[model samples]
Target: MSRGDAHAAVRRRVCLSAAVAWLALEALPARSATTQDATWPEEPDPAPGRGTPADQAPIDWPEIGLLDGRRRAPQSWAGAPVLVVFWATWCPYCLRHNQRVERLFREVDPARLQVLGVAVDRDERRVRDHLRQQGLTFPNTVDDGGLRARFTERRVLPMTCLVNAQGRVSLRIPGEMSADDVRALAARALAG
Candidate 1:
């Protein structure tokens, strides 16, 4: 073969090898740069100035402040699985995801799980009204942005993570997932 043709073949082989390597990297399970514990007291410390509300839930646990002047911490649900979703009112994916989540919430056994919705949007009124118009009965809170940023990876919307009963983050998902998918994820989270 001509030298030019040989060089072209070499380049093609190199490109193919690089593409394969990239795909292999992508297929691996994603672990956070900051490792999350799989199971109490081992949970990451609360981000400073989290702006959790004063009238927190009566449950004795870590207080994750809410929008309605209340807070529900992971500890509050002590021994029960906790699902926390970091969402925004304007995110279209979040709107659809919430609908699926509503169904999951209804079908799931509350004694085995707890869900926390954190709205990172600044306008509490808009967030509250939007959720109401959508008939979302699950409790949600408006974060001052700190808590959301802390847990968010890629700063994406509809990030969902599950803290197992032991206060460890069993799953940290960042993107929209179907109701069935979330249920499957939750099943694993709660089984802890």
Candidate 2:
């Protein structure tokens, strides 16, 4: 074959190969940007200050309740740095943070800081039994009416909101947090 013809044949083969590769890639399904099996870091990266805006009013806790039980206000958080944690007994991450929370309650002065658990589980008996089994002494309010709607409007479990002494939400942390993160948030809230 002529040199020019040979070169042209090679170019045609290369183009066909490139087209096949592009077609194969296009035929494959696209992967989701978000991952379901993402491994969370032991120490979460520094997050932005996603706190409640100053214009947002403080959440009224008393207006919320336990399943079929009387709704009562949070007495412990009155005029103190409050940690309002929305968790459930069924969530593994939530259960893991329970011990950390208990330890924080013991270490931190209750007069200066208070952690109130808000169980978002639909079943109150399960939560109560789990808390009792875990020997958790902190005061907890049940969200039978799904009071989470009043919080950050996010439907994620194990969300924690640090409320300052001035009754303002200073930080809203979604998902599990390490003990250090909790302490840092508590210290910030107390200092503020």
Candidate 3:
């Protein structure tokens, strides 16, 4: 090959190699600063008018259906702290957030704190399956229209709200949060 042709070939090979490396890195589950620093969009607070439902104390657990064929009745866990996660089965961000929350859930004292994952989708089976796939055993409840409508229906999935022991919102994270944030919220929840 001519000298010019050889140099051009070497340049092409280097470009191809670089492209392959970039694709391989993208395919991996990224745990770098870019992924860690990146976060889902969030709101300072949940949607307005989600103020306590009539005859319901603000921040109290509303009646919702649990995954295990059981029901979560209001006031049953009244005095405990609830980390309410409003998520959907179809959201990839929700999947990632829940996996982290599940780790936090396992670490915390369930007796003093609770993680209530409220699935916004109508498909109960999908929610259950997703939770199972994530290996999350924390109590998950699929929101039956009324509960979700009363909460934020602004289309942002994976919203988190920390309701303290006295049935009031202490922290409102409308999108994805770090595991450290979840742990800090747990500490605040338990302190109340």
Candidate 4:
């Protein structure tokens, strides 16, 4: 081959290698970050009429059906810090966010921090398949219409809310979150 041709070939190979590396990295799960690795700011007091539904005194969360063919009554979680996530199966952001949540669920003591995923999709089978494919065992329930109304449907996927032991909503995040952010939220729940 000509010298020019050889150089061009080498450039092409380098570009291909970089592309492959990037894709592989993208497919890997995000590294779990401890709460100590990042700082979490306190949430500001909500303005009048601007509060989320869970912001109500002891959110009258209705009974929810679990994926495991069981029901979770609101009172069952009355005195525990519960992390409720509203997500859909097809949302890309939810895919990444749920992975971090799965990690947090596995790492923390269930008694200290209860995690619940509310799948907001219409197809129950799709939600189940997604959870099974992702190897996520955290308690997830397909959201019936009631949950959407009760949670006040923020029109955003992967909405994560932290409910303190007192049943007060402490924080509500409306989008994707980093590993440190998730950890810090759980840390705050544990501390509270």
Candidate 5:
């Protein structure tokens, strides 16, 4: 083949190879960094005022000490729907969501529902002060990665989950929510 013709053929071959590679990458299913088979499952497009169903496997809750010097055991609130919230002090979304959660805690009976807050922040004093200032009496514990891993791998702030009376996680929400939505969580848990 002529020199120019040979060069042109090589260029075309390279372009075709690049196109094939691009197509292969584009055809692959998109994988999120937060997804894990062992962790809680997620919905493609979660509906407003609703939470997606999480893993059916029952959660093995460890004995956790509340910031208020109280200790909570699984048997203490057995056969009750438990609301577990993973939050942080600096997260603005968590701040607002926590207030609505506090209201829900007060409105619902302890026998019907149990609320537990998991603060991912290292500052125990700040978390305690924030809860105290908000007049939130719900039991909360500061996590050093141990407790958080049992629930979710997503680092999203204000992650919430509803563990049913049987200790199975029923609903898993990964972001902030409205007051009405928080109120409906109890109804959803009881309805099942």
Candidate 6:
């Protein structure tokens, strides 16, 4: 081969190697960020007469159906620190958080805290099957009919909101959380 041809081949090989490395890195698990400020998207001002808190207004829980077929209304979250987590079965990050949530439920006292999982899957049957296969015993809600419209409006996902006993939203974290993170958030919510 000519000298020019050899150099071009070497450059092509380098580009291919870099692309492969990037894909490999993308496949790895993500670390939990301490703050979700940088991750959550900004919300637009509400139209006239909406009369709602910007952050809390965008979360429509009632539209989502809990595992027991009951609507996940605000009343359901009353008298406990509710951790409403929006996730999907296909998302790896979401799956990882699901495992962590299950562990938290097993270790933590339910009387003091509640963890609610909202699956964004379009197919309710598939979601139910997956939940059964995984042995996820906590209350899970499925967001059908684009019930996630509010959450999507805020550009949040794998998101979690900490609701106080009064049914008021306290904190919103817009990323994956570990078991330790759940415990810490619960502790703070209970203390308050």
How much lDDT does each candidate structure score? Answer: 0.70, 0.70, 0.72, 0.80, 0.79, 0.68
* lDDT score at residue 118, model 3, on the 0-100 scale: 84
Worst 10 residues of 3 by lDDT: 33-42
lDDT of 4 by residue, 1-192 (tens): 999999999999999999999999999976643122334343433444545434476667888888878898878888889998899988988898999999999999988899999998888888889999998889999877677555454567778888889887777677788887898889888998
Most lDDT-accurate candidate: 4
Q: What C-alpha lDDT, on a 0 to 100 scale, does residue 49 get in candidate 3?
A: 49
- How well is each residue in 49-101 modelled by candidate 6, as lDDT tens digits? 43333335424446446776766565555677777778888877777777878
lDDT accuracy of residue 103 in candidate 6: 80
Which model scores highest in TM-score? 4
Return the lDDT, model 5, position 81: 88
Global lDDT for candidate 2? 0.70
- Runs in model 3 deviating more than 4 A are 1-57
State each model's C-alpha RMSD to the native: 8.4, 11.4, 5.7, 6.0, 11.0, 5.9
Query: Would you estimate the TM-scores of all the predictions?
Result: 0.63, 0.65, 0.71, 0.73, 0.70, 0.65
lDDT of 3 by residue, 1-192 (tens): 999999999999999999999999999985643133323233334445454322234653566668988887887667787888888888887888888889888888877997888888888888788888879887888776666554445556777776667766655565676776666667767777
lDDT by residue (1-192, candidate 2, tens digit) is 999999999999999999999999999987532212123222321333433345456766555554436555656346887888888888888887777788888888888998778898777788889988887877677776445655566666688877777776656677777676676776777787
- Indicate the TM-score of model 3: 0.71
1 against 3, candidate with superior TM-score: 3
Give the lDDT ranking, best first. Answer: 4, 5, 3, 2, 1, 6
**Candidate 4 minimal-lDDT segment of 10 residues:** 33-42
Model 5 regions lying over 4 Å from their true place: 1-55
Stretches of model 6 off by over 4 angstroms after superposition? 1-64, 68-74, 145-152
TM-score preference between candidates 4 and 6, better one:
4
